[model samples]
Target: MFQNRHNLSERQVEILVGNLLRYGVLFSSALVLLGGVLYLIYHGKETPNYQIFRGEPPAFRSPEGVATSALSGRRRGIIQLGLLLLIATPVARVAFSLLAFMRQRDITYIILTLIVLTGLIISFIAG
Candidate 1:
């Protein structure tokens, strides 16, 4: 029987995954909080006009818009970008799992993870 020299123990893999999730959440949370603070600083004094259902300004509706807004120091854009990051965290975890499974020579898990990744991509693209 042949042994893979580079294979890691399950404990090490779990630790890496745990750290990935923890750091991803923390970093995304910090971004959101910073955006919130900036938003409050910029618009804290504005009076609420609750009678009308005015939609979000055009700049906040899409990823590109959010990025542009963030670059221009728009608080709302920053918030949206943070939200995007939050959404991406799990996707990133899945991707990382796929890589880990590949590295571990886990054929079953690799295939399963690939299916999951495909579904995620399709849903995001078509839904």
Candidate 2:
């Protein structure tokens, strides 16, 4: 029932999406772990001052900033970048599914996926 007329099968697409999610999660975990280790190594001895509440720096607030900071070897940035990647994994899956649906000429799913994708983009921008 899942077979398609083209070379791309639904089962194959499922497998690919599964792999994409698995690898994306694993890679993000690794980044976060690495960042944590680095952070601990550098700041483990410091005591936190609970009296003051500090928000994240402006440099860690946006994707481009996170990428730049991560590339520059900032520990918090690395962690933030990992979180960003984790968030992006499902979005990537949705995008891939959209492409797959287009390939299969499944207009219904393609439209639905587009709507979902647009919503995601809007939320990201609005936030």
How many backbone clashes does every candidate have? 0, 0
- TM-scores of the candidates are 0.83, 0.92
lDDT of 1 by residue, 10-110 (tens): 66777888888898888888888999999899889999899999898999777789889988987878888888888878888899999988988899999
Task: Write model 2 residue lDDT over 1-127, tens digit each, in one string.
Answer: 6655465588789999999999999999999999999999999999999999999899988899999999999999999999999999999999999999998999999999999999999999999
**Candidate lDDT (C-alpha), each:** 0.85, 0.95
Question: 45 in model 1: Cα distance from truth in Å?
Answer: 2.1
